[model samples]
Target chain A: MDIKNILISVDASDNAMRAVDYAASILANAEGVRVTLLYIERAPNRDKFDDEAAWLNQCKLDHDRVFDFLKTARQKLVAAGLPEASVHERTVLCSAEPSIAQTILDVQQAEGFGTLVVGRRGLTKGEEFLFGSVSSKLVHNAKNCAVWVVQ
Target chain B: MPESVRELVERFKPPVSVRTYGTVFTDTTEFMNIGYGDVIKLGGRYYLVLGDERERRFGMEDPKFWVKRCVEMESGQYRILKLEFQESFDQHIGSLTITCHRSAAKEARILRLVAGDMRFMQGLGVRDERGNLARVLERVAGRRLDLNIEDLHQSHREYFQETFPGILQRFIGACRAIHHLHQHGETHGDIRRDHLYVDHKTGEYCWIDFDYGYDSVENPFGLDLFGLGNILSFITGKGVHTIQDVDAEALGITEADCALFFRHRVVNLRKLFPYIPADLNNVLMHYSAQSEVFYESVPELLADLEPCLENLRRA
Candidate 1:
C-alpha cells in the first residue's frame, strides 16, 4: 500500500493507454507517489524489408511519437490531481531487441519502482498469441516489483 | 426368505423370474431382466447391485452400480436373470437388495423424458459436447487435433503446423463467448477445450457448462484466460513447457512443482487421426496473448481478437 515509485511503460497502443490510465488511478490515491514514464525504442533490422537508414529514421519518428504520448499522459495525470513534479519521463534507445522483456526488468530494478504497469501487448510477441501471452518473461524477470499488465 | 431381502424386493413388484448366483439375484422385468438381490445380469441388459446386509444394518450404504445392457429381444423371449449371493449361509445378506428389471420401451421412454430434458442435455452438452465438435473438425495436413492438454506430447511435433490457420477464427468465437459471459457478470471458471463445443456445420464455438461458474465483482478473468491459453497448448500438443510455451504461467508461480507438472503434461490427439490443419497455431497464439490481459475481462480481449479474426478469414 505504500507505493513510493510507479513505472508505467507504454507502447502507444490502446492497451498501453489503458495501463497509463490505471497507473494514474493508483497514483491518484497514494500520497507522494512518483511516476516514471519509460518507452524502450524498438531495434532496427527487425523489419525484414527496411534498410538501416530507413529504420533509423523510423525510429526517430517513433521517438517523437513516444514523447508526444508521454506528454499527453503526464497532463492527464496532472488533471486528475497528481503533482506534476512527481511525474518524470525517460526513453532508452535500443535496437528492437527481442529482449524487451529483459529491458523492462532491468528498468524496473534500476528505478526501484514498487509497481510496474504495462499494456497487455507491446513489443513482446505478435498479436496471434494474445491471451496466453508470452509476456511471462517480463513478469518472471522482474526482481521485486509487482507487475500489473493492463489488458 | 430373509426379512430384509424379502422387504427390499417387495419395495418393487416381483420379477417374472428370479435366479440366485454368487452374491446377487437376477430379476427379470417384462422387457429387461434386472439383476437384484446381489449383482446379477438379467437378459444381458440389467444389473442390480446389492448392499451387504450387515452394512445396511449399520446404516452403511449398498453398492450402487447400475449396468445398462443393449440387447436385441426376440418376439417371445421372456426376461430372465441369474443371481448370486455373496454369503449363502447368511439368512439376510445385506440391508439393501438391488432389483434389476429389463426396462421396457415405455420405461425407457419415461426415463428419457425425465433425464433427457433440455436442461440436462444443456448440462451434458456443456461438459461432453466438445467431443462431438472435435470429431467434426477436419483433420489438418494428415495430423489430428489434440482437443485438450492431456494430448500434448504425442501431437507436439505437428502442433504448430496444424493450428496456425484456423486458430484465429476459433479464438474470435471464444473471445466473443467469453465477452458475453463477462458482460453478464459471470466468469467461465473452466474454459478447457472439453467445455467448448464447435458447431459442425458452421465451425462456430459455443461454451458449455455453467457448473462451478462464478459471478463476482473481482472477476477471475485471468484464471479463465489462462484456462483458454492452457487449452491452446493442449489442442496444439505443445504441452505448456515454459511461460513462452504457455500463458497460464503469467500468475507468477515460476519454479514450483506445479509449473514442472505443466511442463510434462501430455495429450495425444494426433494418434487418433492424422489430418489436422496448421492454421490453428495462430489461434493458439492469439488466445495466449489474451490470457495475459484477462484481468481486463473478456470484452477487451474480444475487441483485440475481432481484427485478427477478420484477417484470418481474409487469408
Candidate 2:
C-alpha cells in the first residue's frame, strides 16, 4: 500500500493548533501527502454532570470548540501549500472512543492514515495520568502509524 | 455398603503391589524439599537459599514452598529461585469449568520478555540440572498491596471514598501494564492480591508471580481478567466477602437485590455500600455469577473503568 495520508488531531487549545501547523509545515511541499483534520467532540454526558443543563452547556462548548479550531486548522493547512482538495476534516463523537487518544487511533487505523500527528499538551506526568493527554497516549499506543507530538 | 464401613475395610487391605526384587522402581517420584542454605545449581551458577525473619517463624510450609529467596554464590546479589511446583485446580462458573494450572515455563517466558519493565515481575528463566526451567528473579523489596492496606482503621465507607481512589489508580496502572503485556502477546495469568506489591522504592504497584494458567478457548486471558475482578472485589470491600463470612462481619446485609460471584458470594456490593457509584458497581457486576456477559479482555475492562475512575477523581 502506498501510505500517503497524515491524520492530525484537532483540539481547541493553542497547542493543538501547533500540531496542525507542524503537520502543515512538514507536508507543505511533500508530494502525494494528504492531510486529515480530526476532531473528537469531547464533553461530559448528562449523567456525569449534576444537571442536564450543565451537560447541555458542556456539549455546546465542545461543539463550538471543534468548529472554532476547525476553521483555523483548515486555513493553516491550505495556507501552508496543501491543496483544498487534499484536506479532509473529521468530527468524531466522543462516545465512539473509550478515551480520546484511543478514538483518534481507532479513526486513524480505520482510515488507513500512515502518520498520526498530535500536539503535546505539556501537562505534568501526574496530571497526564489522572486526566490523560491524547499526545502521550498516542505516543505510547499508536501502532502501524507514525505519531508526531509537537510542543 | 455404608461409606464408613467401606473405608474401614480398605484401611486393613495391604498394598496392591510389593517390591519383589532389589531393583529400583522407576515409576515413583521423590520430590526434593528445598530449604534454607539449600544450594540449587541452575544454568552455570549456584544459588544458596536464604531466609528472612518471616521464614524463621512461619517456615516454608506456605503453598508456594517451592519458591525460595536466594543469593547467587558468584554475584552475591539476591534473587528468587522458583522451582517447579505442580499446582492445578478447577473453578466452576455456571456451566463452564475453568481449568487453572501452574506453568513455570510461562512465568519464565513473561519474566524474560518484560525484563527491566517495572510493571511486571522481572527475572530470567534458567534451565536447572533436573531439566526443569526455573526462574531467577530480581528481588523487589516491597510490601504486598493487600497486606499494606489490610489493617486500615478507616470504615468501609471512609476507606472507599478517601483512600480507595488512590489505590484504584495504582490498580488501574497495573491493569494498563497488564494490557501492555497483553499487547506483547502474554497474559499475567496470575493476578492475585499478593502478586501486586507496592514497591517501597518507586511507590508503584508492581506485579509478581505469573506461573498460573487456565484453559479458556474463547479468551486465553479470560482467567486473568477474572483474577483482576477478584482483586477488585477484595480491594473495594477491603476483604474477601464470600458467602461464609458475611454473617461474621455482622453488616446486616441481605442477599436480596444482590449478585453472587464464585462460590455463591459477593452479595451485590452496591446494596451493602449504597455510596458506591453505580457505574463502578456495574463494572464489578460483570464478574458476578449472574452476569450474562463477561469482560473478554483487559482493554474492555479498562474502557469501563476509565469513566468511573474519572468521575470518582472529580468527586
Candidate 3:
C-alpha cells in the first residue's frame, strides 16, 4: 500500500514510545509518505462554563499545548528519515461527542489518512475488562485504511 | 471443605451483579428523562442514574460500529457488558444516552493518581454494543462561580477583591494542580478560570473538568502557560472579555489579518493592563504574549509565580 498519510496515536506511556519506534523502523525507506501524530484528550465539562466565550478561552489553551508535542514528533520522524516538512501533528479533546476510537476513525477519513498506527500494551484480563483498549477498538473500526497495532 | 463440595458450593452461588448507571440511548434524537439517582439494569447489572439537563451524551450507529464493538468485546480485556438499543424513540431531535462502565472514565485514573489530594466530580462511562460511549459524572456540590456571565462579572470582581488573598491562594493551588499533571507527562489541555471550584464555607478548592489532548507542538508548555496567564488576567479583572474590547490598532495591526499575525496583535498584555504589578505582569505577558519570550515549561513559569505569591503572603 502506498501510504500517503500514517496517523499514529501516542501518549507518555512506554507502549506509545514503542509504537513510535516501530513506525520509524518500518517507514525508514518508505519515501514520500507523510506521518501525522495524534493525541486524544478527554473533553472539558461544558456545563461548568456559563457561555461559549468562556468555553472558547479553554479551547484555545488546549490547542496551544499541542505545539510542543508536535515539535517533538516532528524531530523524531525527521531523525527516522521522514521528511521534516511531510510530518504533521494534531490533537483532539474528546468531549464525549464520539468514543475515542470513532473519533480516530473520523479523523482518518476526514484527513484521508491511509494508515493508523497505535501501541498494543499487553493489558491484564482484568485491566482490559475495566478499561477498554484504544488500539483494539481502532483496528476493528477502521474501514478502507490500514490499522497497525504495534506491540 | 473438600474440593468437590467446595466446587459444588461455588457453582450454586448466585451470579454477581454488574453495576451500571443511567440509561443508554442510540442517538441524540432519543427522548431522555434521565436524572441523578435513576437506575438502569441490563443483563443482571444495575447502573445508577446520573446527569442533569446539560449532561453530555454519547452514541453512534456507524458502519464501523459493529466491527469496533466486536473487537472490543472479543478481546476479553474489558469490563463493558453487551450493549443493545433496547428501545428506539420516534423522534431523534434530542441527545442519546449510553450506559458507561464506571471504571471507563479517564477521571478514575486521575482520582487514583491524585489520591484525593484534589477533588473532582466523579462519573461513570456508558458504552453500547456498537462501541458508543458516554459518561455519568457526579455533580460537584457548590454554587458555580460563573464569572463569564456578563451580569456576574462586576459582582465577581467585588467578591474577588474582598477575598483577594483567598482568591490568590486558590489560583496558586490550581497552578500547583496543573504542575502536578505536567510532572506526570500530561497536560490539562484546557485550563481556564471556569474549571476552578471552591467550597463557599471552607474555601477548599479543586480544579474540575479535565479536557484537552497532548501533541508534539513547538512549545508544549506554552498552551497551559497561556491558559494560566489568561485565567490570572480574568480573575484579577485585567482581561478583556471580548475581541472588540481590544484595540487592534494600538498593536499596529490591520482589520484584514491572518491567524498568525492576528494572534501577535492580540497578545498586548501590557497595553491591556499597564498598571498590573511588575512581577505578575511579567509572568502574564511572557506566557500570554504570542510574540514575546514565552516560558518553555510550566515549572519555569511556576518558578517566577511562586515568588510573586510569596510576596503576597508577606504583604
What does the interface RMSD come to for each candidate?
Answer: 24.7, 18.3, 17.2
**TM accuracy, model 3:** 0.43
For each candidate in the order shown, give its overall lDDT on alpha carbons: 0.45, 0.69, 0.52
| Candidates by lDDT, descending order | 2, 3, 1
Q: In model 1, which regions exceed 4 Å deviation? A: A44-47, A50-53, A96-98, A122-135, B1-270, B273-315
Task: Name the regions of candidate 2 deviating beyond 4 angstroms.
Answer: A1-151, B1-34, B51-65, B85-97, B242-260
**Per-residue lDDT tens digits of candidate 3, residues B1-315?**
234323332333224432222333333222244333233332223333222233221233222111111102111121222222222122111121212211123443454456546445443445433343343334455544334232343454454345455566677777777778767655565565566666656666666655334322323344566567666665555333334665656744332221111233333343444443567656655533233244546678678877876665565
Scored by DockQ, the top model is 3
> TM-score order of candidates, best first?
2, 3, 1
Candidate 3 lDDT over residue span A1-151, tens digit each: 3356899987545687778888988888887898889888764443334346876887677656555555666677789899878887777776443556777888888888888888888853222322345786687678888888989
Report candidate 2's fraction of native contacts. 0.00
Cα distance off (Å), candidate 3, residue B291 = 3.5
TM-score of 1: 0.33
- Per-residue lDDT for B1-315 in model 2, tens only? 334323332332224442211211111112245555445667766555553213221234334466767667566677887776556677554344546677776787788788888987688987665556677888787888888788898999999989999889889999888887777656776677878889998889899878766532223455567778878887888876665655624665543323333444673677668788999988888766456556757889999998888999998
